[model samples]
Target chain A: MKLSDLLETAREDAPAARYTVDDVVAAGRRRKRRRNTGWAIAALLAVFAVIGLPQLIARPAAPPATPPPPKAGPFDLLFSSYRSGDLRVGDPEWVSLTNQLASIGREVSPGVYRSVGRLVLYPAGSVPQTFWMSHPKEPAGAINGHEASFMPLGRSALIKADTLLTWRNADGSMVLMASFENRLSREEMVRLATAFRTTSPRPARLPFAISWVPSTMRLVAVDVSRPEAATALVTPDRPDIGFELEPLYEQAQFVSAWSEPGLNSAPQPIGLSFPRSTPGNASAPSGGIVIGVQRSFVSGTGPTPKCAPWSGQHNVRQCVAAPDASSNLVARAGHDVPQADLERVAAAGRIVGTPGDPEAWPTARESFPASAWVER
Target chain B: MSDKEAEFREFVGGQMEALRGLAYLTCGDWQLAEDAVLGALARLYGKWGRVENPQAYARSAVVRAAIDETRRPWWRREQSHGDAMPDIVARDEILNIDDRVHLRQALLRVPVKHRAVLVLRFLEGLSVPQTAAALRCPEGTVKAYTSRGLDTLRRILGADLSIDERLEARHEAV
Candidate 1:
């Protein structure tokens, strides 16, 4: 038989598929939900970590509580599904940043720079819902006779860039919907909030671990769904330092740790030393340190690590390539951190479990040494 | 249903069988092939609205995912239907069945990259450039793998394989 005939016949006896289109759609929806929430949570965390949270801690008090509306429309379907069009609706994913909630959004354009209309659902008795319930709310008209309260706030009351619509569900759950960049009108925000639905809650996961951390730092934010990154910001010692953590290995295998100056202080360390990533006309952050692990294939076993400086701009990072060349671990310390101490921190890192299996990797909370974590 | 979802369903319904067949050939086991296709399709579903040509995306993704499945440690994959070579038996009266079994064995014997090249070039009717694009390799590398794969098959089959080499030659000429 000809080669084509042989190839065709070889695949003929394969069994029927074990999954259906619906199964694929369902999985897709879950992934989309997880990924969307992951990005928003990461952004919120980045803001708090990099910019500092003194303003949040200094709130005088929430204004007097507003009475609940007499009636509200059913919003059960909004969380369970998606909306498409000029204002494309996204799936809801669980948020565990400060409180347990399911966060969802609708966007005008699905790009990084585009504004997303935000909706956060807090379960009854959650800290955020209770705190929000204590605050006075502005009447923003009604949605199908259900009274809605509007607040001019962004992710939180501290950043007042967005217009927020708040209300209570029949189940005593609290819903806060914000129109980012004023992309959605007050009426649109009310309508979206009224039509909102709920889906299964999905919690994010951390990709890497840290066995040691300085006493002054704490993990303030994490984005686990898509890029799988976390940030631990330093407090008290100096408000300017923070660590950016992510998985470095291909296919999200090896977890890594990076450090930089405060968000408002300077360009991120990665952008400085790596020209390909350099932000426009940005200067390197001074008095900052960075540590990361990079995965690469090298022939042979038990090769000693070779540590050296990078050839790129800023000329920072003392890197130690693994003996097998399977990975490269680097420590870049500015004047703030002693070089020896930075090396000690870098030395504490070791890849755990089977390299490629994500399940085998330790949880972000589990990956770090107990001493490394500081509760706020 | 949203048009995005309906479109994805139609695409999946139409392409599911062909993709399964492609994946099975790429990875030598049915179970691994199925897993690879499902994983690829699940990811594709998330990007359904954005991906301009999902068939091309699914084809490349399935092929690569199948390759990745093969890279899993042998002991781990042993729980599944492993790719252990079968013993050669005497030629039977059922010539088609015997030839198919023999052909499968021979195909597995070829190196994975070369085997992938052969599958893409022959079964999928992809030209050297198209195979190169699918496999993300140079066209010259595709030609070389095709030659090496054909040689391996010829040595095992113990026959001069009669297949059109004209497509490769024609593309090379262009």
Candidate 2:
């Protein structure tokens, strides 16, 4: 039997199957709409939080009897989860700098890492959650002409219970408070208070400002009151630089950022089990940021690689690269997807956009997305 | 939640089944697809009042929600909704069942770009132009995908698929 006859026979045999198309289409379209609405709502809430959050975040109208428990002293020189038994003898350089600050009452504690011996440098007597930095180390080899010096820490927000904040001094010496509740996680602030020989103290009103856009992984702002006010410096002695945050403040009306040099990124591949994704079979690199598909492809494996040669695997996939030159790549998109769905994620991005650099903006069309090749 | 929640619940009752089927096609996993549909319907329930094309809006919601559900870090920890092993032996019985399994297998083998087209064209019975309109792709792309999909299906189903292709040509001439 030919193709049409086969289809006709199939249709005659299973008239119900005809509905599968409409069913799948309707479901996909609704689901996508549902997701976009959720994201829009979530984003709106985030924006609202930014605007209306002042009230919630506003220091309590009635001050607490005692300020929250300050974080422990800067315990830089963190140990490796795989290697170290003690926090003192670790490899990360940020740990070393933190340890030096700790010698003089600076405070630093790990925020989020496997075995981070974090440091929170603080002034003589102040709240610990003031200034903060995760493993900040310089890039090895000939460094780029960028500042990796210290600036005073500014405002602090309790992103989590254990996490704290701190600021760098103008002399570029790290200073500020990092707070922690129990001992689960501590900030640099407690370390500073101890250095000043204070039993307990809570510093308030951060000395700086920082902002991040998920669309771009960059933080920009300045510590208006840093003591030394040196350029942000990078000093990764060996390979594998640690987290060094710098300002990328640009004077713009809409929104601008002070770019911190160096790309601080990890493989954020989302572990998506596409019907097409096989067991232990290599999947073509793919992923994209659509209106609703945040962290596409599941989050465990991390973000899909954007470029390099590869066949598109899943419709939900982002940027994909082929495994081989001739390995056939067959991207299977369901007919159910609305025309708008394809255009939603396939927007034409910049030829090359640098991460953390807001200037490298994605030229996205609000309505129709122009597809672009993502070959890194 | 007072009045709005009740109203949304009523609206969801109407759209749940259709949404679930669509979700199943998208993920190819029934339970996950149902969850995705529920999640989408729940969200739709929230905005039932403001939605213009409630059904269209719901459809979009399902597609995008399923997509996001695929993105979570925890999503990796989960895959199939059930542990039913694939039935390779009982796959090629009736053309419909065979077609479903065939399409599913071929779809799994096909790249996303082509698969979507196949689903839109063969399953959805959308004309090339309708598919282009639905996919927001150029007509050429719809045609290209149809051609490419047929070729890929040929490879996966081998001889079985060829007979079907010949049938399709005969039907088109008729």
Candidate 3:
């Protein structure tokens, strides 16, 4: 019999599915309750952190004889500020920055702030601008002594000439000021950069942070299944397109998740083929697809890597290894968002807070609040 | 309940049977397929409003869950009904029934992903692009899987009936 005939027979002979609508509705309600419980626990934790209840509950025995290994970086002092949750939306410092930038645009939405990150969007006429700040990978260099980088947004050339200005605070925190309208002058940007200040450190919770966000998108939802695996969803103001930032446990997982399926089901001979050639050097093996390469990492072991990221239409996944080599961060986008933008955003993923604590990151629902969206 | 909940329930009711069938084709076991479908439906219910294409998303989730189920240690230990192939029928007595049983047995032997591609492309009648979106893989991969899955099924069915002959007959019938 023909393949189509067999498939048709299978479909026709399939057993009757036995499930009631009530069964599904009950399951959904249970899921909602569990999700709400998770949020409640997170909120309680935030309250406890704010009230210093952990200290009051259990006073620690006095100091160690050895001075704690000198804090790793100058930013260590700023960790307390992050922990205190003092950098949140209503903080005087953030309020002052918002007020100072009011001339350019009004705050159209409530800001989303974590211990080490802050995101606030402003609408100026047809353009959507954002004020974002987070701890930098390293101390940011000064742009004319103001600790900022001002350059044209490099993702697209046809898109209007938009500029991005990012600067560092005294405590090693970095702020990103970008204008989609291409109207912010360098002098005005520098003046705005000077207004940021280092507030007192407080205990705060921030699950994860991304170094770069696309001009048209805002951080929406973050779902942390575990510390090593978190998914951040981003949607544009207009809701035409959205994407996710997914953290896989290892490079192998990233490769398997992204790899393209081969042309045949039978295992193809293990080899490499370059489908897309590199731009400059014809001989340089770049941009071509790699097929069935075995990954040698502590966490990966299997035949035929199944989840590697390969090029695809509509969806593009770009993965980069974390600095510690413990995990891979993948940025995935669909529906009109360019690959260059995804790669830049993926490259900018930064892990803040304790690496493995599930509580450090916000749940999916909490990350994207109703107030976060600003209608066009 | 709420309007959103009612909407989600209606969607689940409409899509459940098809998704369950898809899951069964992928896993080759009724009980496991049910579990996968239920798990996927529960997750879909949670994100009903947020998901752009609930049907496509549900299909992907079911496929992933089915694949995940096969990886579990218990999956190998479980004795599915397909584990024991039915008694072979006489050559002409019940040829159609025999073919169906043999087809199912052959499908059980096929790899998880190849089986998934076949079920989605042919059984569900999803376009290459739609199948790719459902599987969250490249379209090229789906095309390849389709070719390979059919080839595997052809090999398992018999050497007497060439794939060319079957295709010619199918085309003539159409």
Candidate 4:
């Protein structure tokens, strides 16, 4: 009748889970789609404000054509959903008095139309790249008879040699076209911008999933250029602690890897003994390391380990390896956290699935094979 | 099916029962417990790859979601329907069943924060710092809440014998 026993008894009569996995997945996808739609619209509006376009209440008449529009690109269908008056299309601060022109401005080429508050483009690829359209200090020039502003590609760390292209819409609205992956020259940028048409925004999906979130922590940002290497930033209610999760592709390589120089070089060895009595007791390598001021512990031969070692200069960390020797999970806390507590956190590690497919691990009480006693 | 989807389904299937139980213990209502667990699971599904410790994260999420449900206006409006205490026969049986029922009722009387601390610490076997981390509070707060919560439960149960002593005795008998 230990306290643990009482707690277990209290929950013995708990009801079964009513919802299925498919239901939860569906709900998650729906929520993500809604959030992505909002982001896409916001991005479109921000792009419009760069070139100094007036807000339009109604769709204006098409201007007289000067040149034939170019043929529609492969991605035209993806960009055709946006139109004028689609949720406050233009920003007031960007209104250009001198460049005020007819609404539904002339088509610079086939499939491309310049309107008061819209410039739609259908890029060929399905994958979206980060595009920056404006830099405050950059100089302006003319492209395809429209005043254009340009920013060098090296301006952003994520972009290499590409250039950002911005031009005034025929109705005086601004348009920007830039791609990090494809470096387009001034003429190509102009041609592509002139041949753009709006398409429906697709639902956004995260390449990776977060099976776990610390209590009181809200997911603030996600970086997923590669699904296997995705990272999630979570901010706790307390401002003092910062938490992030990144995949450890190879647990053994990391565990055996050399620690950074100029940091504490001493290896503080800690031991986690596996009890033979527990179910599914996998024989793991007995040794563990509590390295540096972070005190990150990496152990176990499991495929997917639950550990999150603080990436920065934090003094306390708990890293655990899965039973399969594939990936490691690292959790970092501030130096204020006691060493004993950090060990306990490390010992609490559980493996869900491989890095390629992260599932929720079984609870420690049910699946933690053998009681783990920490040895200093 | 995609590998990610298949993996997610396996995770959900394995952990659903435990999460539901934890949620039920925290919220004291089956329906709300289910809602809290499902909500947390849905969120976890969206973040499956980025989470480091999915079990810990799921537990923390379930607890927080349950706590959040109690604070809602609708949750507050619903009256708590207390469970009927089992009829006591032998003195030992009373100590086992009736005492548990009494302790549970006392737990509900404790403040939400204190109750959460008690449940996480005594029930989930989380360390002081781990409980603090899960609740997003300081270790000192967790220690204080634990002390106060146990005292409140002790008073509510109104047992002349120390609960610990009785539990120990019961264990030895078993």
**Top-lDDT candidate index:** 1
Fnat of every candidate, listed in order: 0.82, 0.12, 0.45, 0.56
Top TM-score prediction, candidate number: 1
Predictions' DockQ, in order: 0.44, 0.05, 0.22, 0.25
Model 4, span A38-88: residue lDDT tens: 899888888776543554423356753544444432111223222222211
Candidate 3, residue A180: how far the Cα is off, in Å: 82
Of 2 and 4, the candidate ahead on TM-score is 4
Inter-residue clash pairs, candidate 1: A77-A197, A78-A196, A78-A197, A79-A197, A79-A198, A79-A199, A80-A198, A210-A368, A303-A323
Give the true-structure RMSD of model 2.
40.1
Task: Using DockQ, give the best candidate's number.
Answer: 1
> Which residue window of length 10 is worst by lDDT in model 3 chain A?
A94-103
Per-residue lDDT of candidate 1, residues A71-166 (tens digit): 321111224434544443443322322332222333323432233444556554433623334456689776545577876643433332356677
Ranking by DockQ: 1, 4, 3, 2
Candidate 2 local accuracy as lDDT?
A: 0.36
**Backbone collisions counted per model:** 9, 131, 23, 39
Where is the poorest 10-residue window by lDDT in model 1 chain A? A247-256
Better of 2 and 4 by lDDT: 4
Query: Model 2: per-residue lDDT, tens digit, A1-376?
Result: 2443333332232212223333434554576687899999999999989888887787688878776646533221212212122122111111211222211111133321222223333333323321234434322211122233222223324221233333344323333222222222332233322232222322111111111112211111111111111011112122232232211111111011111111112122122222222111223112212211111123232212232222443333333312222111112222333333323222221112232342232211111111221111
Error of 3 at A34 (Å): 1.8
